[model samples]
Target: MLGAIYLSQEINPHNVMVNQETKVEQEGQHFFLRSKKDFDLYPTEIRIQLGGCEYFILLNGRIDDREHLFQKLSLDANKSVSDTYLIGMLYQKFDLEFVNFLDGDFAFSIWDKQKNRLILAKDPIGIKNLFYSVDSGSVIWSSAIRNILHIVPNQKVNSAYIKSFLLDHPIANESTAYENIYRLESGEFLVCENGHIKKDYYYQFKIPSITYRKEEDYFQHFNQLFERSVHNRLRTPDNRVSIPLSGGVDSSSIIAMAENINKKDNWKYNIATYSIVFDEKEADERKYIKSMLEKYNLKSTVVYGDEDWNFKIDFNVLKELDEPYPLFNRALASKTLSAAKRDNISVVLTGHGGDHILHADLNYLGELLKKGKIINYIKDLKQWKNKYPLHQILKQNTLDPIFRKTRLEYPSWLKKERFADMDLSTILTKRFEELKWDSKTITAYFNTIIRQTGHEWFDQYLSNPIGVERRYPFLDVKLMEFLAAVPPTLKIRPANNKYIIRESLKAYLPIEIYGRTTKGNHSFLITKGFKEEWNRITEYYDFKILTELGFVNGEEIKEYCERWYMGYRYDLYNASGIMRALALEIWLSDKQDII
Candidate 1:
């Protein structure tokens, strides 16, 4: 939503021409700023002069705590607080550490003329995106990668990124698909001073060691933090917001919390619900969705997901995506956004980060065993046996990590020669090293801060074409920290995942909605789409871009796809690979068109 260029001393700042999308522009001695209209209610960018230091800020999302910050910083509370103005005041007061006080889905850049310093930072949870490329001492940054690519065409592809994408893992650093272009990671910042660029974390994930002895205390804390997150994100024009209600606990819990807040505080807001229905029984959650609607007496815009899937590419949306993505249920996601757009809704709240933050798996069982808690481990094991077969639980939680040297299952179609040096498996290993699996706190941290960062950016950018900003209440930093600090037992019990969420919202949610254990499996939609468009998929493979790029074995991939198509048995892994291969080819073809 915003882009800026800090030119080197040699290049004339006046020669820089920003993109046409820039609604607001500011040029300083060494920097030229351009930002799009993000929120109609707030200015896109703010410029202020304080203590002989010229300051400019471009923000993509609102700072949720700006009002509190105004009082803390002793600013004029009567004056309206815009996102940019509040951040400017914070910087003038707190200096560089101003980033730590921010809480929201935002990506922003701060320019200080007095110090000749330019600082670029992303939010702690990375719900918003910030990408930059440093060339010959000048730096270019933007919320959208396409803007940076438009300025400096990045033709050279990064093989590491390709490997990560194919394997469905993050690149483990700031490297993007294009060489020399970098994405700022969550809680990270880049500082340009004295013609030198230094990168460090403005926020670090410190798992709090404090634990409340009572379960009620944890429940009370969660309700407060989560309600605050939802309330903060609901700050839109006229208090109107849209939600993607899937009938699952994550999305359902958000609505329940919001409704509770509305009734408790005597506040009013409009919530439009959008849902994707399926003809296939395996993929349908209509029964549960119906329960949610009946319980709340709310109507929803229904999207027929089965009718929506096809192997067609929308170049307009595809080109906007900076990299190839094997998006889970693309049709469903697109339809949801389109529905929100049709309703004239600007903000769409999603329940994405719940599984990452709240649902800690049985891996914590392994941790309990490792920590010499034999008695506790036995009790936990007995509880897990009720849900899963005893053999399966032990193999997954205990045997797998100890015996397996590497967690990655290298695809046979991947060219070893092309990725011979990249240690992709070490991605998970490194995270485990930094934070051990001694508790579900560490497990939840791994699932969220480490693993879910890529998906956060992908979801945000996916809504770009539809012009709807997607917000995640579950990814709230305060709520995440609370869940991470709680005992693993509170997260995963004998037969339930996200035990705390299910238990905490008992008053707000109906038993049918909260007590449900299984989630709707939409993977069937992937294979169903692939089968429906089999001929077109084959034709796409004929393009041979992956083979030309030396990243895949063309014959092997074709054979694998043929086996999946002809075989009667369902193979989830093969289905996933075929989808990713097709996605990569489509992206490559789009790249060729651009070239």
Candidate 2:
């Protein structure tokens, strides 16, 4: 949650410390430091010896000059606080033995003067932002890519990354929108010494052995673990919390559990919930949300959407995101987080990882069925074949590459003839080559982070103005291990995705949500809104810049935009590509003088 910049210069140690400290304090986090050696006879070291040589630099987010607990602990020598603090404190205590013990959303760097080395690490989930680059003779770290730009002037756009980002939304792991700048992936650490960088993984997710002997046993264990995860997040003395309630199973389950805890403790804690409602009926789910609120007696607020928020376009919302991200239903979460900041809420709980991990999409079950699980396959086919309508199930086999190729062919509305000179394969192949990583490694990296840490990258990067702290009980390490232990068949049986989770929460959640067949489909909503805006914007952009830039074929780009608005969903791929290209053009135009 804090931004830090560290530099060691042989030319001037004092000047370097002063400059770094000033920058750190300007970032508005507490700033303190201890020298490697004492200069004055009275001891320049700000040392409080707790039977250890580890020097502490404490920063208070909420208070100033509060009673120092470490001082008190030094006096008592045996008193105990929560294990969470102990985990963080021990890293500072046994500096050599345990240089990296961290939890929660944090990024820290440990510098060992004795060995003339430095180690940098991010939270397992990457809820905190950290970026680094080494050039000439110095290593630089910063919380924002812009901050790094302040010190390193030669930064340039990585054109290959730009192509991949245009094809996909968020740049994949370790790749930044900028070329030379690189992000430390989630659950990873970097050790730098003697001008060499070594990267290593500190955490990995593993499937656990199933121990539940009966249905009730599974239910009991799940309930206990679920409650513990919720309780851990609610440890703050003040029980006021916020949940982004969409009337979905994930958010509803969290709200219900938190309310239950408040009731049990005889606490009059306020649960502030927020939801977004679009003007269009197909996009709005406010009616269902109202039902859930009435059932739970929860106080809630709604932020009505305005189609005419001109600032949405002016802000260049896509460029502001930490990575290239898919539209994510047109950035509703960004708007929600903006409102939450206005309300002065610090921590918000979300139901993000539940669907991905526990209630994987029903298609996963169909894949299992295709791999030949007889009864499960038959049941899934009968229940979802009509609803989801998988082509693989209809053919009783996986789709051939030829069929996939046909599906990938550009539509006629896109004007393939106009774009015939553009070599898309060359672009894609160049992106793959630039990544310098195999598809399997990329897939494994994503899977490990999601399973272990949930979608921390989204929570960390998306929340702006000031960052929003987010808690994901579904991605709690204990919960993931438990879910992984359950057989995949039992987890997604009888055409019910997240079968085990649904059954466990049956008593607590509304029956309507549990029995719901369709997930909340927001593509139509986003497509409708984007089509209109894209049309209006492209008219100004196509003539004003696209033709002049020469990187994009302006007429072809216009056709692509029209095809998208004319109700071609696949055309979004092309539309997104143009959007990214336009964004880059704007960025370069603005920074043209700087270059």
Candidate 3:
């Protein structure tokens, strides 16, 4: 991806602006650029000089194959294109709002000489990352944090908010692990000129409550949007596709739809389904997986994930992730990505993000209470008792919402005495502090959908090296917009969650697949991976990174590690904190010459 900078007068004239690739600018320091070496012919860097003024633009992703925006810019259809045409259109189009008019996964920057401004933007969903640090009067931006680290070599790790990272997963704000370094929020366009910076949000996604009396209308509209989302992702080289299947409703739904589309289409690559399996029946989900395979006559690849656990940090993995992340599913993702690469697959369609958007939440019952629809609430409560008892119904549907305890906290492990003694946040950004308990209806669930994801950073971050683009239909803009407008009752009806999906897709999906209520369990599989790799993980575990920051309880953690593998010690060895600690070891110890 693209990494760039607009140099200011405050820079050490002969110093920070000079690099292996940087040339001494005769006048005020100009643009500096770098691109990852592996993203095919995508623009590494592009520089254009007009009227004695030099300009540069670098793009780190593919333009959409569906939209011919480049054609309007007088360019060829491409997997990768330099930002020349886009930069030209900025001045020609004369509108700073041109970004939202296009679609693709990219993080790009434009250095305009005449205007003397550096503009940086990320794609709509935040799939691509752009981070910046404005110091010494210069605004430095890049696709990766490591590149910006070049300017501030001794950037202190922001241990103050490590609690936020461990709990919410993504920081969900401008802050990064390093001091003064901030990530560009998704769809934000930043313009920095003459020591001043201004930001504009290019997209807004909000949940609005709307309902239709005709149920078929909702189903038909959803199907059209769903198909288009899948179709847009298939815009790849040779239509190579792979699905990571769990036989759950979401993945199975994608498979069912894709199989139907494939059967009726012209010459297209046959889709492959990859299933992570185990020798133990509790862990293996082949029985649930088999119904779809038998129905569709599809090709399948089964691999044991936990059998050979790869918990030790690989050098390549260390190099890929910019920060320490506790994505425990890295082993499964990396292994599957390697397989996709071997099979020449260019895009892997996933069913992540479906749970949050598709499945309705019990929190919606709060809406019924607020609206004073007591009779409907009682009827739904009767159906709720089919699964949960009255006490749980009261606690989750009423008491919790009334008390406004809707916010998810750091797991029990993070609350241990070791962590309590250390300084945590008394002052938190609004997001970290509390939730809007009054809006705990479907809104709470929508917020939850965005917080965490099975489509983890490892899956997206490792894609460049492995040459696979993992696309989630569930996160599609059109699909989400449709879901946002759907009434919560349509999402959850009686005892069924994702009521619309189950009811709408029953004809296409296998009977067993559509009717299945409980999802497959992976708790044993995950614990097994940790148990097998405990020694090797703890042996190389250096406590210096934590000690240097004074943020970790080294003695407490060491004690927990000694006993964690023996049994379930939730607070002592919380899975979240342990995995994060292991990942942090690699991030803190790295001495790579990145800058």
Best by TM-score: 1
lDDT of each: 0.72, 0.53, 0.64
Tens-digit lDDT string for candidate 2 (45-155): 222233343322221111111124345335344564433344335545555334233444445555443334556676555555567776545566655565556556557
For candidate 3, list the clashing residue pairs, or say none.
none
Cα miss at 355, model 3 (Å)? 2.0
Work out how many backbone clashes candidate 2 has: 3
| Top candidate (lDDT) | 1
Model 1, TM vs. native: 0.89
Task: Sort every candidate by TM-score, greatest first.
Answer: 1, 3, 2
lDDT (Cα, 0-100) at 191 in candidate 2:
80
Candidate 1, 58-143: lDDT as tens digits? 77777887677888788787887677877887888888888888878788888786676888888877767788988765688887
Q: Ten consecutive residues with minimal summed lDDT in candidate 2?
A: 36-45
- Where does model 1 exceed 4 Å of error? 2-16, 19-30, 38-43, 76-78, 170-172, 310-312, 315-320, 391-396, 399-406, 429-436, 439-457, 563-569, 590-595
Worst-scoring 10-residue span by lDDT in model 3: 427-436
Candidates 2 and 3, the one with greater TM-score: 3
TM-score of each: 0.89, 0.73, 0.83
RMSD of each candidate relative to the true structure: 3.5, 8.1, 4.8
lDDT of 3 by residue, 122-191 (tens): 7666666678987766677776777777766777777544645644455435777777788887667898
lDDT of 2 at 176: 73
